[model samples]
Target: MAEVKLHGFWSSPFSCRVIWALKLKGVEYEYIEEDLLNKSELLLKYNPIYKKIPVLVHDGKPIAESLVILEYIEETWPENPLLPRDLYDRAMARFWIQYGATKCADAIGALYVASEEEKEKAAKEILEVLKILEDQALGDKKFFGGDNINLVDISYGPCAYWLPALAEAVGVKVLEPSTLPKLHAWAKNFIEVPVIKENIPEHDKMTAYSRSAREKLGKN
Candidate 1:
């Protein structure tokens, strides 16, 4: 058996992505929960550049960044594949995942710390980015990977789970049936997956945490 270990924080969607990938692939890994306030020395040692959580250590090699870890998990396991087998499909999947990482994520983060006067603008920006994703990448597919969850889905896990909590915390609605219906449905289906449902952070707890984070950000 391969020695696998994961360093992560509980409330982070990025950490949840690694957990979901490991569970889906049936790879056994020891999970180490790190406090973001005071990061573990091992975490700092492993991810010297970023010093962030969601670092996966397979055997003795350490891989940092959630998306990078997800790819490593897929390539390492290869049994229950998280990426598409087709070359073009794989490329497209990666493209959408990158899009979410770059475009959608910024808007969502902006919304989280937006002032009362800036709230509407920030919310609109996220909605617009998500709408593009819904129409272009997702379309009518049940999942980003069509029949099953894949890297794309895992990459956007925050949009499914954390975004709603952040919206609630910041007093704005982004993913709603009234606005982005398809994406809204996608969120519902994504979370209901047994691996996702079982592994995700508690919603109420996350919402409270987001509220506190927003307040702290406001102070800064």
Candidate 2:
């Protein structure tokens, strides 16, 4: 087996996604925790463009971006497939992952720092997104990928863990059971997966971090 090393931060959902994928594949790896504020020389060397966490180094080759690294993992270690076998389902999964990448940040940013009225507006927008996700993507499935959690669920890991903390910090609710029950249930089920449940940051710690992040957003 080739040597695998993961560069990540514990609190980052992006990092957690990579961790979950690696664990699911039963890949053995050395984990290097990077301080986002200081950024290690190895992380700088590996991901020069993004200078980001969650870089996967396999046999001295570096792969960056959580989603890109996920594809690489799936392709490299094909034992436990993270994507569908059918070509079109794989494409759809990628589409939803990309969609989450583009829209999720915007939806979360609304509550990151906003006036009371702004929170209301952002909550509504987030609900709309969740509604679309529940109806079109997740539906009644336990995960986005029917019975199994796949790339789409991994892509939205932040929504599962981070968004609730953010919403709590900002005093807004987006993933309510009443409005978006499927998505709400999906988030619950996603986090409860043994690997995910074990690896996620503690909720109180996340809430504290969310508060700090929101404060920084307010300043900027």
Candidate 3:
């Protein structure tokens, strides 16, 4: 059995982030496809707290949370360095990653669950968040890490693929080319990377899933 085992769901951006990091690091691991509704015994054993997918089990020791798992991967591999070498640069990278985890995620999640009357307001909030990301974090860089992708890029992986899919499903335009050209272009470039392009969930499937999820949210 492989020492590195990953339990993940197909349509999950969190899972995709780990997948991308592992692939970039050239790590060989066993992948266990998890059903969120009927989670596996091992997954529950591994992550008793959250019982979430994207758990990275290395030699029977499990690491829960995608960001924590990502840091673990970077440290263990040490090849294809995801973080910058400079102290300041690395700190900045972490800062943006943290921002994505908090502010960006909250805004996007709000938009996802927004009612018809609140959709526009939710979208505006997300746009404001993205604008900051574009201006402060991204700027004219091809990727957040600049030239090539780093932890910041990986951290914001959902914004590249899942956000667009979510926007389509919700019938709201959040990352528009006309309005936020740089961030829009960044999304396009991020997805086009061979590693990302190959690993991401299908857009149509994601949209359908998002739409279904919204319907379920409405009922509850």
How well is each residue in 1-220 modelled by candidate 3, as lDDT tens digits? Answer: 8999999999988999999999999999999999999999999999999989889999889999999999999999999999999999999999999999999989999999999888889999999999999999999999998899999999898888888888888889888998899999988999999998999998899989999999999911
| Candidate 1 residue lDDT tens string, 8-43 | 999988999999999999999898999999999999
TM-scores for every candidate against the unseen true structure: 0.97, 0.95, 0.98
Q: 125 in model 3: Cα distance from truth in Å?
A: 0.2
Q: Which stretches of candidate 1 lie over 4 Å from their true place?
A: none
Candidate 2 per-residue lDDT over residues 95-164, each given as its tens digit: 9998888787777666677765688888888888778878999887899988988889988977888888
In model 3, the runs with Cα more than 4 Å from the true position are none
Assess each prediction's global lDDT (C-alpha) against the native: 0.91, 0.88, 0.92
Q: Ranking by lDDT, best first? A: 3, 1, 2
lDDT, model 1, position 164: 86
lDDT of 3 at 12: 89
Question: Looking at model 1, which ten-residue stretch has the lowest summed lDDT?
Answer: 211-220
Instruction: Indicate the TM-score of model 1.
Output: 0.97
What is the C-alpha local distance difference test score of candidate 1? 0.91
Better of 1 and 2 by lDDT: 1
Worst 10 residues of 3 by lDDT: 211-220
- lDDT preference between candidates 1 and 3, better one: 3
